[model samples]
Target: MSRRWLSAVVGSLLALLLVPIAQAADTNLGDLSLSSSNWAEDSGNFPGIWDLTQGDMTISFTYDGNGLVDASGAHAWAELGVRSLHSGGFNFNPNSRYTYNTTTFDLRAEGSSTDVGDVTVSSDETNIYVKFVVNSGSNCTIARTRVQAGSSVSGFPRTWWGDAVPSRFNHQTIHSPQVIEYVYTISRSEVGDGDVYVAANAQIYCDTQRNPRSRIVRTCIDAWAGGVPFSRIGDTRYAIYDSSATRVDGSGVWFASDYDWTAGTFGPDPAGSPSLDIDDKFTISRFGGHAEGDYNLPQTPPDPWNNTHFWFDRDDVDQWQAAMWGMAPGVSYNTNGIYHVVITLHATSATAGTAYMTVNGASQGFYSNGWKDAEPEIYPAGMTFTGDMQQLQVFYGLLGYGATHSVTFSDITIGQ
Candidate 1:
């Protein structure tokens, strides 16, 4: 009623509005932390949980007690759709679904969403989907801001059920009362220090198979008491293995391509007559680079264990020479390496390519054999990459042919 009293009330409201809103603390939700009465309402069955930590992400499913299915344990799957999630603390559901097939533990992103980079998922436990987004793990400056929900067929979007029964799976089966968890991890770099929202969904299928006939059990978003806090990472989100000390643990030779290099061994050991000798090539002991084909020698070496050193014995080869040829399908010579002997390949086209070799990290320039018109006289047999290429390879060589006289190669890496 009075001007003075009205002004005082307005001032108090303004002060409250200006105060910063409190954020949730970071928490680890391992071993069914969501299967508690405190997480859900005092009366209802706990639904599922979507949790994010500094370097880990997870989705969990628990009985919410809405009583959608019986307790014999049906095959269940969980999905988390990005509605609005990023390092900036804003969520916008753009109808995108990041689906996790619980049984197979396969993670896929659909709905034309384009916010982050390639994401790979794997699982050791059946109930949970644990994954790591490779690009997000490597680059911290990049951020992942996604929405909580999407308009996709994968999660079976529903709208009828209310609070008592939010969503229901199409088919029902017997599932015991246990916490089913799906987990994934991204680099702190991908998560930065921001708020992210994931639209959570789960499915229950009969006959122990996952398909369209499966029922939709739950569809919702992740919520926390304090909210998931991403603590600031002072250093890089990922580790670097470039230096010798860092990569000294690395062992074995990396064959450029599986098609040319004989199985069980790398290219022919430094040959004197420039002829391929399958027996003289490097041995296949440890699993390092991706293998595309089988090897010539079937003998399996004892587990390489700490036998991490690669032996590249070129002393026997009076000369290093190669004939240029096009690369085979599903194969390319990756020119990313760091080492005492570095090989750089440039493909001008599908049929033509050139190569340059280096030793001790110095520029040996292109092969000394010289280029011949469109065809190169001496190109790496496995050379396949084209355009501004940088690879890492390390070489330790002794100049002899006896079993004792071989180049030891170890520590292979690609530039970031």
Candidate 2:
């Protein structure tokens, strides 16, 4: 997809609409106790909100009489909703909502009045599972269920489910306490030490209809295994390169000529009265060139860098026929199994032209007249990374030479 479109998708995915809670004689289920048998209740209350924070914990709930019962005792319904959280990764956004990382179910016809239904959350080395169980003969049946595990919540009656469930069960009815159970599973990679939020609601078919919803039951999960270590490879100021395109100073910036496959200048200019200009930032003009960073050598097994963000200035789009600005992991480590590369740069194009952002040898047109975040992901067949090695590098190319076509860059970072 184009960089602009990709950025819009990212923004839309992180947008969350706030839900409104109806006023009622609600109850707070309080924090879930370590004891699974310790059930909470909201006696004579129609709606309620609950709160809990724990890992590998259990919580149970019961209403008027193990079901939503009005003075006339007509309605009997149950509803459950669960969501999780994730942050600091390639595709993960901290504000985005997630479904249960994992879930399972255990249904039984318990004879206890307070033990009508319960929700359990647990995790393993690689996955988290959430279990929901509704005992039989509680007079309350699971009229609806909502599980937001992926892009959308999946269950019967899609009309009643959105970013969150309705405040009460709908007119739909299920067998009275036939022992219902539901389980959901998600990768620990997707949750990364984030909290899981669960909410429940019930409704009684009284003459006027009274619905009650619980607060939230939050659960904690372990941290992600692949820890991300972010570090800047060079100083903020541009480093001067020698005749051989090697950093003459101590700066880690170096030129890479092995990738100059288009018969272009693969390093800092060597003859135009000052092939490369260095002030607070650096400039690249005319023939294509690649400035690479010097990372720690021999990253055995190749710990791949997942993300890199940088700032640049392109003032004249008509300077060249075909121009492209791109970044990649350095050319010292291997990039295997790295299927996707997303580049987000904060800058505006001077004018709409044939400019693109190249990633892993894949290119996508870039066009932005106003300053905005342009994000694009490149996916190619077979080996996604076709370079000699993987490290951090920023390069630009000009297919049809234009002496004035130059771009300035600064503050580049490579990490998770």
Candidate 3:
């Protein structure tokens, strides 16, 4: 007899003794779906699908249609597999096998069943927290976990904060059924009011080469503590006239003029003497002793033009006290509270000329002519002010009487 004919006769005899095979129907277990149709003998072309959908997460499985039968005719099997995917993607091989009984055949699921569990989010006044539970199953272990935060949900790493794997739980083996809690604190300055979105993921390794990730699960929390309110009282970048010494806002907070060096020897010059340049920068040209430009607080008294070189009166100490304590002119200044004063400028001098800035009586000299960003002078908690204070003063002068000196200031800002 022919080999094909003999094989067919053997298959017919076995079929007569075995129970009838039933048609494959779609099966649903929790969030997983095993979908297929029409069971038949090994045809070398059968394809099945296994789909898993959880909260905001979906995974697709592809069957390779390569079935293997036992040499002793005891069982037959096929595998539902996954293609290589990125982080926060899923991987698994759900083996569908049929074992022969005395008169019937049974199909069942076997092998690794790794998956991601519940992902929860919470927040307080100062921080936002996230937790991820990974069910690694008995055969596999978790390799890594990652978390990210953003303004919205759908855009992924584009809108997500902390970069591509921001908060990583790595370098350790997490066995079956363990929960990994990840907490990331986004400062109040980085987040705004309303909902804040977050996403979490976990990767599992079944063996040496098979490593698949769970689908990215995303959620949001309505946790946004309001940020510190800052009232800007001065900025040279806007609303300042090109050639005028005083600010256009009429606050009298910015002036480029000379201050009195000695009694009746040199007095405060006109507001236009060391006026603003065409670039809207405060410029102080060559001038006599104690030529200075200043950003003064509101209600400051006129220069006494005395030989003592004091800007504010010693008797009315409250004005001096407020300026030293980060009190901008119009805003309600916080005493010893957080405040920022930033300045950016450059200076040039001929012969022995010099340019320096004095803030709250502390002096920092500028050495280079290139644009420099003076470190933001911040007055944080627990600061005490003493002695005579020069609040944001820029002084330019020459050592030898006749040499020339020039100073330009820009981007001066005061906030509280």
Candidate 4:
């Protein structure tokens, strides 16, 4: 072989060796376009949508008294508050649904802008899980998102009266729409027509009561795409909600604990005597700080989220107030076995977001987007996670005076 050719080959080999390895990661966005069949009756109430439309799966909107505007798309910063959606047919997914891959429509915020409205729709699938990525531009909010799935005459999740598969996930407690993941389970036998109503940011999405931390940011819809029968989310993944049964130590509120917030075969640090455990739910609130109970939790602890004397569902924006509400004196400790807590936060802002856990009042790590390998990841489904903590904690102003009201914990996993 020629010396020049040999030298070039050696150089190429070194370059290839130096290339960095890329681990799996996911981008938090959905790509949806608007339909072209833009047609609204002169009254603007009843319209016709045969073709034209354009928008994204996650839409950011701004709605003033005039109407709603697209804050992030082509119409971004464009006020079309008076616009709306129209259609003929509909689908019946209770959690969510989407237009056919071929179908598309545009949001026409034109005349007759009402704070409340609906979009033309129909069922394309069953048990559909839907979530609208909502963002605010104007200080005010009016953007709303709704869907018309079929009716239900038998009644299951709700009363049986509607003609088609009925819907769930509506905030019966509040009218303000939320940045929530809605799960609609439509029985194939009860298939029919339906549509939805979605307002922009303020009125349409989740409204934080002056504080984002105290707010319920999102809801979840467990998936059955992996050749599995649909069942309650708790029966499937560790991503289920926090329930009472999951509480092994603290009853109503969260408190500092001595257990390790990290996941492992042995469980949090020393695998302390007092721990939080859950065979059903995921979130856990245990006593730490003193391990003996009622002190300021471990200082400069191993877990970061444990920094505050209180630990809880990511939703509990204010833990210090627990003192005002009587947090310190009445606290109790678990005498059973060493319990470990993995507090996860579902970042409502991103589609595939993150959360974390706390140990001895310290911030630990993050709950990564549930993606194991292009698939929704699981936090080591087994008897224990004697490895690392998959839970997390936020440094947002949530713990201090400057923090807005917010709900931090998304889910928790308690185990030995």
**TM-score against native, each model:** 0.19, 0.19, 0.18, 0.19
> RMSDs, each prediction?
27.3, 30.1, 37.9, 27.2
Task: State the C-alpha lDDT per candidate.
Answer: 0.23, 0.24, 0.25, 0.23
Give the alpha carbon lDDT tens digit for every residue of 69-172 in model 1: 11222111111111111102111111211222222211122222222222222221112222223223322121121212112223433333311111343222
> lDDT by residue for model 2 over 153-239, one digit each (tens)?
233122321323333322222325433555556565554444433222222111111345553333211110111111133111111
Which residue runs of candidate 3 sit more than 4 Å off their true CA positions? 1-114, 136-140, 153-181, 206-416
Residue-level lDDT of model 4, residues 190-244, one tens digit each, is 4332422221111243233547658544322211111111233221110111111
- What's the lDDT of the predicted structure labeled candidate 4? 0.23
lDDT of 2: 0.24
Clashes of 1: 59
Candidate 4 off by > 4 Å: 26-187, 191-356, 359-416
Worst 10 residues of 3 by lDDT: 235-244
lDDT of 3 by residue, 55-101 (tens): 11111121111111112212222211121111011111111111111
Q: Output the better candidate (1/3) by lDDT.
A: 3
Give the C-alpha miss distance for residue 343 in model 3, angstroms: 54
